[model samples]
Target: MSDSNKTDFTNPSTFILVGIPGLEVAHVWISIPFCTMYTIVVLGNFIILFIVKTEPSLHMPMYYFLCMLAVTDLVLSTSTLPKMLSIYWFNSREINFSACLTQMHFIHCFSVMESGIFVAMAFDRYVAICHPLRHSTILTNHVVAKIGLALVLRGMMVILPFPFLASQWPYCRTNIIPHLYCEHMAVVNLACGDTRVSSYYGLFVVFCVRGLDVIFIAMSYTQILRAIFSLPTKDARLKALETCSSHLWAILSFYIPGLFSSLTHRFGHNVPLYFHVLIVSVYLLVPPMLNPIIYGVRTKQIQDRLLWLFTHKGI
Candidate 1:
């Protein structure tokens, strides 16, 4: 194609995203599943939040962390899924440059916040398991509130740099993000200017936030497992293991796919685009869908409260 026929890479207004060429069919395949998952994720998290708030028996440090987790799940899913579903169902894929950056900002912010929440929960679990004698003192309500504030502050400090760096780059070119959601890397890649700074900031934030959270979670689980085994009675061991199991499952499900997707984006972009879309969707959508189910089924208190709420409503 001649220069005149070539799409302008410098004119943000003229750039239209033709969305991964022939993969528009994927939109049809994705729409139903995404909508269903979003419904379940929102409803599930809301239920957990309600149960945690309403049930006096659940007003402990552990449930407090669980409530935070539910809030994070709600925010995280809300950030991306609505826009994605609109694109898939309505074929409205054109995103403004500023809007894209805004989406990217919230996506990173909530994601980092969720990671911070996970670390906080790990610490809570650690106190409860390893320092049971001092659990109440160590993880007092005041301390939990401080931890929540720290998580928000740390998440903002980690993720805000990406959007700042992104804003510096003039979107002299395409506005359409290839993926369903406005991912930081995807949006930055569309920038006509240098993205090295934005990319570096993104990497730094991911490593510092997600990486540290994963390590801390690992350490917490190590101590938790040791404590469980050290229990004299089988019933005691089983109970300890049971308490941590849901958390372990949640952490693994949240992090593993994200790590895989990051690795693939960094090292395996040479792979098929379809694979990229599939993996990204899985990473973004699966955790929210699974989180409520995992916690709901594993925590008996939440289950009982949910049942009570529904039964009362029916009456």
Candidate 2:
């Protein structure tokens, strides 16, 4: 057999992304809400990035991490949503094998990248609260830039195998992906061959990136609380804690829905397909929409800047 035939014989030329298996009739109606949410997602994250990049005073460790988070959200949502909307609006469900792999790559890479940014933000809060006198020295521009690059590289290294693993397997079974987006495991699960390796790798990457990040984020916040309580006065303690509130909200908004969706998909045997699909949809849209809101509402700098931009037409 020739190389091209061997490639074709190994993997299907394309895969069909079935959006909400049981709710085919409602896909058109469903697109309305999702379209609205995606609009908010795009506009909101871009606004956050715009403020961060344009504001000279905001060029610090905290906002720099926020900017990275925004970039991830922007890329992650863009990677998944266009295909999703096409399926809904145009009823275009066919995705080429390579395109599916590309989508899977961006989805996993950006999600892991966002997880690292959260960890970075947690460290920023820890330093600002626990060691304010040395915060600047600890989180210099050079240090933050390096951290950002390292996070992206870590994500790239860990997720690089996702597509390769899938391609190695013989997808001799059905090519219908159950979920809306081309998630790594979703593509892997369609393989006719043994799926243990792909599944285990997916879990391994999640544990290594998100799991450890959560652990360290918890530790950082614990220390922040200890330092806050050690403050000399009530006002001082409250002042210190106030700075951490936005970040905690951001963490909850990003992780809670994400973990819930992943768990429900994996273990919720009795979950209806519509609900499972809805959870996945929420996981993708919620963080992009809420991160900007969380920061805008809780951070004085972002809030004031937003107000000034609106009131003064950005001067």
Candidate 3:
């Protein structure tokens, strides 16, 4: 294939990304939606944080995890959406190499932290449902604090290497990252050196971090299910399942598209640019947009708090 027809797989010293083709015009279509979503994500998560901080009733382990999750979502969305909007609204798609690496690092960090929050939430649910009497004892304030610290440390360990690995490669020519944000793999793929070690390390980290979290979540739900099934009444089972409905939805919304996008990027690079952009946008934006709505509608506490806050504000 001619150079024009070939995908630039080699790393160049500098990259120039002319916004995705056809998307330069399509930015208008996404601008309002993206802005609205960003507003909702930031505001919704802020309210959750505020309520969790101020409300004595929400001082429990579950709410603590919820607060952490809200913080994670806020940071995660901030890590990408601002630059995305800048590119869309102002047509400023250029990003410095160091800036790209920094963005990629935080994106990976917050994403891994979110996974850890999910795992902690699952454990909270398991303790609450499976061993109700001991829930408080098992998930104490100190324990939760420890878990939070561990999550941050673990996420840093997993994601810090990605930027380091990327920095080592000499970028000689093209700097245009096709995607809006500096995705770890996409950035690494631009490196001109032997990326075998980076690729393998990335794969290992992804599976170890995300994969283990998924396993623990699955196990937590399994135990909760068993405990719920042993209860005598249909009403009881329904109520028990209802408690987890929001969490289940959040997990599905966050994980499915993410895994699909990763798979497509790895194996389906031959696909059209539109498909790639569409899948990636969905992976990045949809979860941030949907998370608050799903959790708010499904969790009675959040719903009631949101209602009260709105009523007081008269908006």
Candidate 4:
């Protein structure tokens, strides 16, 4: 009867990571862009943090949410990219089970927190455009602090169970995870025992957090449009609508890739695992790379400060 319960993950000492399957010959080429993007992500986010902290004019509710976004982006990218690079550049794909779980935990935690920040940004725009006078009272320093704390708390609570649940299962199948990063689904699929409960919960969380965030962000923009159209002059309408462009760009950059990858994974039966991994990687990489660029190009204050900082050699 003991033979009936054999599992490769009885203790699960180590796991082999398969970075970009079927493209082993091109790993070097792949690493180049991934490395470049990660560098850009780190540099851009830190610059945003610096600009937001130094510029007093950018210290309002909108920029405060942007700061939170930057922080989440930094942590999330740092959590995944180094390990990915190790696998790609050095071929050091072996990772301890505990370390793998820890990495997955942070990835999910920071992802959820990033979504919360986007939600907060949507609310900031809603108040600023819809109720300019009440924006101050509604989104004070204390309130922003509380919201930030709640975001972190919610992320910790919701994602903490993921790795734990994944770890509980005995993985008799191949210990090779076919992805650049240790994602929840990819890791969980290697388990030998029942995974339906954990997998369903993961899906439910994705729907609850990501689906709802997208819906709310869209709703917020709808109201913002109504408010802009109600303005007395075309110039006033244009000005109000322009303020939303940066946030809209951010939302699209984040959610579109995620949703596209998710839908294709579910429906694209012909799609190979390598393509799926590629989609997931792109899903994670795009936001960090594009968010700062969006802010720099779309937000006048950020653009002006960026140019001034470069020219003046000081903030």
Q: Note the Cα lDDT for every prediction shown.
A: 0.78, 0.86, 0.80, 0.86
Summarize candidate 4's per-residue lDDT along 70-114 as a digit string, tens digits: 889988888888988888889988888899999999988998899
User: What does candidate 3 score on TM?
Assistant: 0.92
| Error at 290, model 4, angstroms | 0.4
lDDT of 2 by residue, 135-177 (tens): 9999999999999999989989889999888888987657778
After superposing all C-alphas onto the true structure, candidate 1 shows an RMSD in angstroms of: 2.6
Candidate 1 error regions (>4 Å)? 1-21
Residue 234 shift from truth in candidate 4, angstroms: 0.9
Clashes of each: 1, 0, 14, 0
**In model 2, which runs have C-alpha deviations exceeding 4 angstroms?**
1-9
Comparing 1 with 4 on TM-score, the higher-scoring candidate is 4
TM-score of 1: 0.92
Model 2 Cα shift for residue 121 (angstroms): 0.4
Question: Considering every candidate listed, which one attains the maximal lDDT?
Answer: 4
Whole-model lDDT, candidate 2?
0.86
